[model samples]
Target: MSKLFNWYSGLGLATKQFIYLFIVTLFLVMVLAYRNLSEAEALLKNQVIRDAELLVGRTNQYIDASLDNVENMLLLLSTRYDLFEDGNEAIAADTLRKFADYNNSIAKTLYLVRTDGKVYANEQVNYDIIGNPMLPELYKLALENYGAINVSEPYYSTMSGHTLAYVLPVTDARRQLQGVVVAEVNLDSLTERIAPMIYQSYALMTRDGNIINRLDSRDKMLPYQAGAYPPVLQESFREQLEAVKIGVSRIEGNHHEMLAVVKSTTNRLGWSLAAFIEEDYFYQGLQQLNNNYRTASVVWMIILLLSAYLLSRSFTKPIRRFVEKMDRLHDVQIVAKLPVTRKDEIGRLTQSYNDMLERIQTLLHKTKSAEEQKKEYELKMLRSQIAPHFLYNTLACISSLAKQQRIDEVRDTIRSLVKLLAFSFDKQSEYVSIEEELEGLRMYMHIQQVRYGEQYTYELDVDPSLLQYRILKLTLQPLVENALFHGISPRNGGLITIKGKLEHGVIRLYVRDNGIGISRTEARKALHDQFEQERSKYRFTGIGLRNVHDRIRIHHGVPYGLRIGSTPGVGTVIRVGIPVLTENDERLGIMG
Candidate 1:
C-alpha cells in the first residue's frame, strides 16, 4: 500500500472507508464478467476456423498426388507404337489387354486410334463407333497439346462403356509418329478410390458436384447427381468449394448445420472427398461450461464476502486502540507521540503523522523571532535619514569665509562644524520621506563645495511633489558620495546632476557627471566581474560604483538595482529604480 492508502485508513472518518470498499467491490465484479465472456468467444471462433483450413490443405495435397501418377503412366505407354502401326493384330490386342490389366485402378478399357479416323478396341461395346468421328474431342485435345496426357469430361466410349482416358502421341520403333494411344480409365473406380474419404455424415463428391460415393455403401456405387443439399449444406459447401477448395463446406442436412472439410483429388482426377461435423452437437457443450462458470463465480464472491467480514472484525481492535491514543492526546497535559518501528508501509505512515505535528510547533517559534528582527532593521534605516541637514548649511558659510584668507572667520567655521556633526549623528529609525533624505544631501553637498573651493558644482533637480514619497534611509546618501568622488576629474572638477522624479508610483533617480568618462567595457566589468582576473586590467578605481550597486541590491533585490551606462570620452550616468513606500513598510521611513 502507498502512504496515501494507509493514511486514509488511519483517518477517523467511517464514511470514507465505506465509500472506498464499495467502489472497489463493484469494479472487480464488472471486470471479471467482461474478461471471461470475451476470452471464451475468441477461443470458440478460432477452433472452428483452424479445423476448416486443415481439411482444405489435405485436399490440395491429394489432387496433386493423383496428377503426378497419371503423368508418369502417359510417358511410359507412348513408346509402344510399332505393334499397332504394323497392323500386327495379335500383338496389338495383347498389348491393349495388358495395359488394361496393369492400370485397372484408373483405366477402364484400352483403345487405339489412327490419324486416318480408324478406331480399334481390345473388346466391343454396345455402341458401334468404328467410323462415326470416333473420339473427335479427344483428337482435338491431342492436336492442341500433343505428347502430354490429359483428363477429360465423363463420356461413354463406343467400344468401352463409361470411361475417361489419358491420350499420348504414339511413335514407331524408328521413332516416326504412327498414331495416338488412348489409355482408358474406369469412371466407377474413381468413386471406389474416394470411398475411404467419405466420413460419417457427408458423402464424397465428384468435381462436377455430384455425390459419387457414400461411406456406408456395401458394393461399389456408381456416381449419382445431387438432387439438392439441405439449405445449410448448399450454402456452406458451395462457399467452401469456391473460396477454400480444400476445406469443409458449410453444408446443411435435414435441419442441422454441418461444416464439411473437402479434398480435391490428385492426378487431375475429378473427385473430392469431404467430412462433416454437426455444429449443433458441438455447441451443446457450452451449456455445461456456463453451469460450471456460474458455480465458480458464486463460490468466489462468497469467499470474498467471508474474508471482508473477518477483516472488519480484526480491524475493530486496531480501531479501538488508535481512538484511545487520540483521546489521551486530547487531554491538556498529555503529549501525542508515536512508537518507532522498522520501515514498512504502515509503520512509516504513523511516523509521518508524528513528524508533521512537530513541524507545526517549530514554525510558530520561528515566526515570532522574525517579527523582532524586522523592527531592528527598520530602526537602522531611520537613523541614516534623520541626521545631517541644517548643520551643514552653517558650516558651508563659515568655510567660505575661512577660504578668503580671513583668519577672523575661524571661530564661525568651527561653530558650524559642530552643528553639522550634531545633525549627522541623529537618532536611529527605519523609513524616511524623500524630503528628509534630500535635506541630508543638501548638507553633504555644502561640505563638498567648501572642500573643493569653487572647483566643484552640484545641481539638484528633485521634484517638490515627490518629496512626500517614502524612501529607504541611506538610499540617496551613497549616490551623492559616488558623484562627488569618482564622478569628477582634473580637467572638469565636477558638474554632478542629481535628479529625482516619480513615474508610475516608482521613484526614478539619476546621478550624472561631466568627468573623464568610464568606458562601456569598464561599466560592464564593474557590474559583472567578481574575481580580480576577470575585472579590467586598466588602472581605474570603482569604489563608489561598486558601493552604490551593492547597497541597491541589498535594499531592493538584484533586478531593481543600479544601472550604469557610459562612453569613453563622454560622461557616466547611474540610475536607480526603487519602490515608493509608506511607514508601514518600516524599511523605508522619514525623519521623525
Candidate 2:
C-alpha cells in the first residue's frame, strides 16, 4: 500500500486521481455505454423503419406530381392542330414557349417524332434530323391499349447526346399519327431526389441496375444478394417498384432487408429509381454525442494541466523576472527588489539571480569595446585599400606603355586614368550621382580598349533620367572589372553586355557575359557565400563579386545582393537589384 501511494504521489495529486477514475469508473461506464449503444441502435432502427414508411409516401406523391406535369404537357401537344403541317414543329415550339413563360423550369420548346419515326429537335428554322428513325415503343403501347397517356422510353438522340427520352405521342382528329413530342430530362434529378429521403442511403443506377461506385453492395437484402441478375440491386428494385404501385411502404429487414425506408423514381422511360439505407448505419447522433463527451473530457484534462503549470509558476515567477531584467540590462548591473517575500524556494532564487548579474557586468566592458574597435578597423582597411590599388595599377599601365614607345596609348591611358582616379578619389560624400559614376566607367572602358586592342567589348544601356540618382561610390567598377577578368578572359573571344533601368519602382542593373559559362552550382555558391565559397572550389575567384556584395549590404539591409545564373558552356548573368527613389533623389539633386 505504501509503495503504491509513493508511485501515485510521483505523478502528482491530480494525475493520480485521473488515472484511477479512468481505470475503474471509466471502464465500467464504457461497457455499460456499449450495451446502451446496442439498445439505442435497435431503437433507432425501429424509428427509421417508421420514418422510411412516411418518406416513401411523400416520395410517391412527389414522383406522381412530376410525372403528371410531364404527361400533361405532352397531352396538350397532341390536341394542337397544324402539328402535321410542314411547319408544325415551329407551331408546337410556339406553344411550348407560351407554357415556358408560365413555368421557367419547363422549356416551352418541343422536339417531336413523325408517324413514320422521324425525330425533329426544336421548331426553329434550322431543325436537324437527330438520328435514324426508330419506332416509339411507348407510343405503340399506348396506341395498342387505346389509352390517351404520356409515355417515356429509352431512346438515343445524336444532336442532344444519347439519353433516356420522354415522349408524348399525340394523334390528330382522324386518328392519324401527327408526331412525337419529346423532352430529354437530366437523369440525376430522379436519382438525387430519392437520395435525401434516407440518411446515408444513396445509390444512382440506371433501369438496368448498374452500380457506379467500386462497392458491389456487400451487405443487402437476400433478394438483392449476389444472384444471376446482380442480387445486390434486385431486391431494392422490387421493393421500390411495389411501393410505387401500392403507396409508400417500408419493406421488412428479412425480405428487402434494407436499413431505412427506400425511395425510387421512374421517369416516363420505366427506368428503375431505387435507393435504401442499411439499418445499422443510420443513427449517428449517439456516436457524435459520445465523441463530444470524450473531446470535452480531453479539453478538461488539458485545462487541469495548465492550472498545475500556473501553480508551479508561482515559485518560478521571480526567477523568470530576474532573467528578463538581466537580458534588458546592457553593460549595467541589475538590482531587483524581491516581489515574493514568502519564505520558499523561489525567494532565495530571486536574491541569487540579482547577485550574479551584478558580478558579470564589471568584466564584459573591455572585451565588448575591443570587439567593436576590431570591426571598425577591418572596415577602414577595406575602404582604404580600394582607391590606392586602382590608382597604382592604372598609373603603372600608363608608365609601361610609355616605355614601350607607345606615347599615344600612354597619353590616352593617362587621360582615362585621370578621369577614373578623379571618380575613385572623390570622397565628397558616401553616395555619388550615377552620371559621375558612368563618366568613370567610360574612362575605364577606354583604358581597356587601348590595352586589349578590341579583345574586350563594353556596352552601357542606362536610363537617362536615372543618372542623377545617388549610388554607392566605386560600386560599378568592381563589376566591370569582373566582366573583364573572370568572364571574357575565360574564353578566347566573347561579348560583354551591361544594361540598367528602373522597373516597377526599383533599379535593375545587369551585366551578362558570353564567355566560358558558370555552372548552376557555381552561381548558387556565388550568391550563398557571397562568392567566398566560390574562391575555395573553382578556378575563377570572386573578389570583385564579394566587394559588391559587402557594399550593397552596408548600404541596404540584408537580402539584397548579386544573383548569378549560368549553365556550363553557356554564360553567366549577374543582376543586382537595388531600391530606387520615387522622386528625384533630393540629396543627390541638391548636391548637383
Best by lDDT: 2
**Please, what are the lDDT tens digits per residue for candidate 1 over residues 240-345?**
4434455444544434444544444422455655555555544666667677777877786666565555445455445566567666675322366777553654
Please give each candidate's TM-score: 0.33, 0.36
**Segments in model 1 whose C-alpha atoms lie over 4 Å from true places:** 1-400, 403-420, 527-555, 587-592
Model 1 Cα displacement at 84 (Å)? Answer: 99
> What's the C-alpha lDDT at position 342 in model 1?
37
The global C-alpha lDDT for each of the candidates, from Candidate 1 onward, is 0.58, 0.59
Which ten residues in a row are the worst by lDDT in model 1? Answer: 531-540
Worst 10-residue stretch by lDDT in candidate 2? 533-542
What is every candidate's alpha-carbon RMSD to the true fold?
A: 38.2, 22.5
Q: Indicate which candidate wins on TM-score.
A: 2
